[model samples]
Target: MSERDAPDQGDAAGPPRQRPRSRAADWLRRRVGHRFPLVARLAWDDYRHEWLVSGFSVLALAAVLIPLLVLFGLKYGIITNLLDPLTENPRYREIAPITSGHYTPEWFASMSARSDVAFLVPRTRSLAASIKLLAPGSDVGRIIDVELIPSGDGDPALEAADDEDIGSPEGHGEVVLSASAAEKLGVGPGGRVEGVVTRTRQDRLETVRLPLAVAGVAPPTAFTRDGVFVSHDLLVAVEDFLDGRAVPELDWEGSAPRPADRAFAGFRMYARELGDVAGLRAELLRQNVDVRTSIADISLVQTLDRNLGIVYWIIAAISIVGYCMSFATSVWANVDRKRREFSVLRLTGFRTGDIVWFPILQAAFTALLAWLLAALVFFAVQGLLNALFAPTIGGGEPVARLRAWHLGAALLLTTAAAIAAALVGGRRVAQLEPSIGLRDN
Candidate 1:
């Protein structure tokens, strides 16, 4: 064959003449180009055929994971909600004397004086023995002092709970009945319940049963535990019984019971703020008041606890690595399926550079679709979880809105992974022997 007719070498002794670059080389030259939407569409069509292999592609599986994400979001929602009530508001500690023997009033007086003590709600415990309850077969149980809270700072809920509401004297030996207690006693405001409570100490027996006029009923909170609260007067009565004394004239009922007439036991103290709880405890120790809050080293112990954000970074990194692997495997499989297409392109004078871009385009489209789906799904999950659990968990806020940076970061990382996978496929095409593609085995 003439030199001009040779096929193996670059075009008829190319060094002999100055010639423009081959069409394939020229196509490979870097240039700003329009985004080829049609090229991407074609690649996506080719990639979609693998769905015939049954089971979802990685991206499809991620999209279907909405349920799992919803559950995680619920847990996150509830946990985040509880923090609002705890971190934003004040909490308290209820204290009682450690009865090495019995708490003296002096000890109570001392603990009440502490700076952290929001209120030294004096309280006493007493059992009812003499009064008969309206409920068949059950006598009245002991009356315990209801710890006074500072919340009456002018809330109508407090005003509505007058002595009649509590079913006790308006201001004196008054006490509130629990809903079940009032029902069992067959009493409303102005009605009476009589019961005897007994507390026997070595060789000492005290029976306290007084007719208690109903004042009001205690309110119920869904989260609240069972208990009852009585005015400080009833507590004083219990204290009088404990001290082996009874003033019958004062025991008489009606609203505006006299303060001097009402009785109490040894004092019980509490503080509204738990932050200085330990310090108050130490102060109580100095004052010889043995009552206190959690003094153990339990809360001091350490755990991962965000640990400088290291664990979070590790989790994020793992997620990114997983994304890359899925993206690469998906793109590679799609590229491999088009091996014959690429072979045909080479023969048609289409540069392998252009051919390799098909897989890259597929990677980009799949990531974009998955990302948009994830965004919509995540927000829906956030809303649903907040609706279901936020109020119950006692959060200050429902849900924090997702930010723009989050979407940008996800897209950037995802797009970069797709590009990386495409480049890997491109490297293979760039090095391919076109003749090998054309040869018969």
Candidate 2:
């Protein structure tokens, strides 16, 4: 035969001539020439056929993850409810002296001048803190505890209001009553009450009566106690009356009197913000003053939350390990059953890498479905728990909540774990040879 018409020796001895690839063909090849789509399709088909195994995998995942999510939600909700107010409210974050010390005017001036000090309210001696309250036009009254809080501008506790006719009374006789104290005294805003201040002399205890009026009633949600909130002036008046010092308003002049040094028991000092509280407390302690803040309680709560989180993670680790084992076992069994199919695919020009994707894809599907189911269960359980216990612990607020990032993280971890578990089956597929299919056939 002619060289052009006959089979060329070069072609016969070597490889056949290849066709030039188009851009579209090259793009397709780059995109999916590895047969990932086929592998995924086959994986899905296998999963459909093995419904029982797939269902069991999903259920196993849900069984482990749902409980952890639920516990985490509960812990988050309870801790938030307990700590939110202390962190959110500037008033509760105030640092106060645990023990009474003679904080002189100079000390007060120094503390008040600090950048960290947002507000400073002086505290009276604890022994003279309690007083009897006399209701208007009634001789019989209740002996109530009084908390001398700082009032006027820059007082973090009290909200400023404009005064008008029939509005809240202000100045010397004005005092705010806690809701519980008001309820007990059967009094409200613009009410009249008298505070009876008591004192102790060298050998005997003395009593001094001071008439006062309720200016406003604090809301029930306030982090205050069953007491009245009096200004610095009223507190000083009570202190002076107890010390046997008399004013012309009360019309009594006494010879017995305490030292003239104006010393406060302690001071309630608020930081500029929550983040500044720790540093302020430390500075106060450095100055040899005993300081107390609700930040300590918040720290304790955070420590508890971290401990609980560690426990939850430990439980989750065990569950994840169990899930991996179960998934790996199932995938191994499935690979064993599909060994011939894998070998056939290998004989048909499919690579080991392509075959490896099959089990991984199926595992991913299983994980996705499981996460969805677990999320549903978690929310349902959260709703039920909140409904049952919200009023008791949360003041009608939801006691369980899950953040969006939490769900995203869980899904990502679950998918990674499932893929890791499926690697065993992928390795098994990679080990098989094309001759296996020929031999089996």
Candidate 3:
């Protein structure tokens, strides 16, 4: 047939040749049409008889890729999750170990100097340490709960709000007490808890009493129970008395960090903020004291992160190896079945490169399709697993969740590997010249 006489090919003058499509658009159309005729057309075309193998190749790839991607996604999610609860509420959850030589307000300020530390707390860990409440005997330990100051500036007491940091309290009219403290003091909303004060220059131990109105009573948190947390003024009173600025002053303190040889046991410290803990601890140890954390709490957190990491790696490794094996075998089998077709394309002037490119493209097409399907499958699997396993562990929502980024990354990497596999198999078929391949057909 004459070049201009073919159907879909018109004379240049006919409708001005339809404005001549841009080279890029024409090329794309031709490529798409050539690569994707119906299944029968692709199979019957001598040059494309092996193309069916690619459809199978993609399925194989997805079968391996999807599981691994989901696992890795879950792992990354979990590690980042560890900091969430603490970050959400910086005060109650985030606490620092006592790193200073003594549990004074100054040492508390120094240790909790970090911005991340929401609150610096000083409390006796155990309840039975000591109790000398004048006209009362409630043993106060570490203050557990911190709350919004009901009145005043809605800030912590001045002592709680640091100078630059606001870790000290806002000197308000009301005091917040623990429920246990209310029970121990034998006082209710308006009550009195008194303490002894001795003159710094005098001989006898003197006593002084302060009346504290319970602003509100809260349950015991990590800190105080049957314990009283009063206004910064009250904290000041205790501080001044202990510092010998009050009536009955215990003498002979070289410095604030000093402790009696038989000071009550159990480690504790507080800082103005969370960040300054390291510096405070180091200085205290420099002054000859050992710092220890609550070993149990630290151990629990570390264990969770480690185990999740290991589980992610193992699943990914198994999936990848299985995919490679399945894809390689499927492509090789297709190549053997179509030895005759490759022989004909060789005789028709298709170069070795063209022969190789065909299967490579086909494999890519299949991988793309399979990856999408696999992604959906992965999500389905995740849902199913959650429903099945969650019930055994008290039936709650999962801590970690998969995201689109994880699946997208998996798809790209899997497709690239599929292309590489296709190229390798295509190369072997391309080696057949017309003489060798034509002989078999």
N/CA/C clash count, model 2 = 0
Candidate 3 lDDT, tens digit per residue, 170-207? Answer: 34234555556555555554444443333333454544
Ranking by TM-score: 2, 3, 1
TM-score of 2: 0.56
Highest lDDT model number: 2
Give the winner by TM-score.
2
Considering lDDT, where higher is better, how would the candidates rank from best to worst? 2, 3, 1
lDDT of 1 by residue, 1-441 (tens): 566677633346556667576665455442423224334555667767655531244456355334334443444444444333333332224444563334455555665576766555444543431123332323544343323321212111222322222222343344455555565555555556554555564576655455555556555420032223455545555455544555455552223333453333334444545455566777757767677454342123112223423554565566666756765676566556556666666676656556667767766666666666766787877777567656665354564344577567766766676578667666665555556556723
Full-model lDDT for every candidate: 0.50, 0.76, 0.50
Candidate 1's TM-score reads 0.38
RMSD of each: 15.9, 10.5, 10.1
lDDT of 3: 0.50
| TM-score-better candidate, 1 vs 2 | 2
Q: Model 1: residues >4 Å from true position, as ranges?
A: 1-38, 48-55, 58-305, 394-396, 399-401
Any runs in candidate 2 off by more than 4 Å, and if so which?
Answer: 1-34, 96-280, 287-289
